[model samples]
Target: MVSLEVVHASNARLKELGPGLVALFVGATSGIGEYTAKAFVHNAISPRVYIVGRNQDAANRIIKECETANKDGKVEFIKADVSELSEVDRVCKEIAKKEKHLNLIFQTQGNLNLRGRDESSEGLDRKMALNYYSRMRFISNLLPLLRTATTTPPHFSRSVSVLGSGGGTALDTADLDLKNTFTGSRCAGHTITMNDLMTTEFAQRESGITFSHCAPGAVKTNLARELPFWARTATKVLYQLITPLTVGQDETGARQLFMATSGIYPPSKPVEGAASASGVSPDKTIEVTKGASGSVGDGGYNLTWKGGVTNGKMLPEYRQNGVSKTVWEHTMNVFARVEKINQERGNVK
Candidate 1:
């Protein structure tokens, strides 16, 4: 397990990486995304970071704080309810129009609702949409820009999904959408496994970009806001009892920022000495960790909260069955259907 001090050391040296780095923080209005966005602003030199979420009030507050913290850095808020794929497309188009390349895509949008399978107007589970589909859509829409970033030396483009990595269960390919077996737990499992497969699939296909799916352990956040008052109260009580063990929000943010900027997790064929590019000396440099494919530095990683490598129980079986391809195909079909509907309604020009 990587210590918080090492995480801080790596983040402290982000300035050596480069200036004017571009990052997009989905669901940054609150929780882990909010904290990490601020960390980026604090560390990066003249970074142009985009904050995407549904809360305008929170966005305004965060923008003010970030701008005040770093006069050289730019933080813009693009408000949208990302649970819908249409909005995701619009947001991505806006960013694509404004920027030539994106250095990082940090996604931490999710919900913890015990209620089962609340379908969006676009015909997918809302929780799953937030946790999985929208994040993948953002990556897909912006991959061209990411590839553009990689054409240069010291090439750096990464997509980090803050989700249940290494916690996936068996996947039921016949019902990837879980329309018939839609329990809260089952939906969670399906999304978790799908994310694992999605990262591996993207890694294999896109060799230049890095993909990571990480579980941020247990950090106190408003993720459970949708739960009933009683449940929320009970959750608060439980967390209070385990406060000593839970990771703090600021530490979580710092750790995630380290993962985002550190070269310890490089692509399949990284530039020489990429692992030491974080400006850390040889003694402090972290060796490249194995990716989800069990290959060292293979462009895709499944990370625990401490930024260590981990593998899900069902990954081997699902990989043998070539389920990652099915997940990718299913995701594309969903996006195509949604875009067609969006065009029909004049949601896209």
Candidate 2:
């Protein structure tokens, strides 16, 4: 496992990687995304960073800090509520209009939603939309530019989703949208499976990019605000009790940066089938970890907060009978329905 000090050291040396690197961070209004954005600006050389979220005040503060961190870097805020598919598409269009290639895309747009099942106006469970659907939309829409980045000078672009990585489980194919399978434990399982499996499909389809589903463990953030009162109170007490064990924002930022750049999960290049597409060997700086798809260097990576491959079961069903294909079809159907509605209302194209 990579140590925190080494992660920090690697992040500090990111300037040597050259300039003009572009990054788009979703759900960066606060918490882990915010810290990661600031760290990127501080280390990168003249990078262009986009912070997307709904809070104007939080955006302003983050932008100002990022600007101060690196005067030459470009830091911009995009205001949008990511729980809605329409907003996700709009924000992605804005990024596409501005950037020709992206070096990194980091997403963590979700909360615990302990209050209960809350659905968005777009007819999706709000938490699932933010955590799973919206993230996939960003990855799907920005894929062309990400591929361009790999073919371009940098030769790689990263897509990292900060969520439950070590938690893939058997998906209820009958109800992919959780319409009928929305219990607390089941909700967590469904979301985790969706996150990892979708990333896996994307990695297989786009061999040039690195797709990572990272479980950021438990950092001390406001992500549990939506929890019911008693649960929230209990969490607060537990957080204070486990002060020494909790990951601070600073450490979390550096560790995420390592995942973005380190050769542990080498960027892919084709070699027959994708799961075995372990092309170039890892560089000397970091130890290489095999991907969730069984490739030494390629395929979708399931990472943990401690800079290690997560030790958890990837449901065997994911590999049987074209499960990945089924999940993609369902996700696309959901997107198509949203797009059709938006087009009919004269709001989208």
User: Which pairs in model 1 have colliding backbones?
Assistant: none
lDDT of 2 by residue, 33-142 (tens): 99898888888889999999888999998888888889999999999988888999999999999989998999988877654567766778887888889999999899
Please provide, for model 1 over 66-101, each residue's C-alpha lDDT reduced to its tens digit, 9 standing for 90 to 100: 989899999999989889988898999999999999
Local distance difference test, each candidate: 0.85, 0.80
How many residue-pair clashes does candidate 1 contain? 0
Kindly report which residue stretches of model 1 are placed more than 4 angstroms away from their true locations once superposed. 271-285
TM-score of each: 0.95, 0.92
Each prediction's number of clashing residue pairs:
0, 0
Could you tell me which 10 consecutive residues in candidate 1 have the lowest summed lDDT?
Answer: 275-284
TM-score of 1: 0.95
Clashes of 2: 0
> Which portions of model 2 miss their true places by more than 4 Å?
228-231, 270-285
The lDDT leader among the candidates is 1
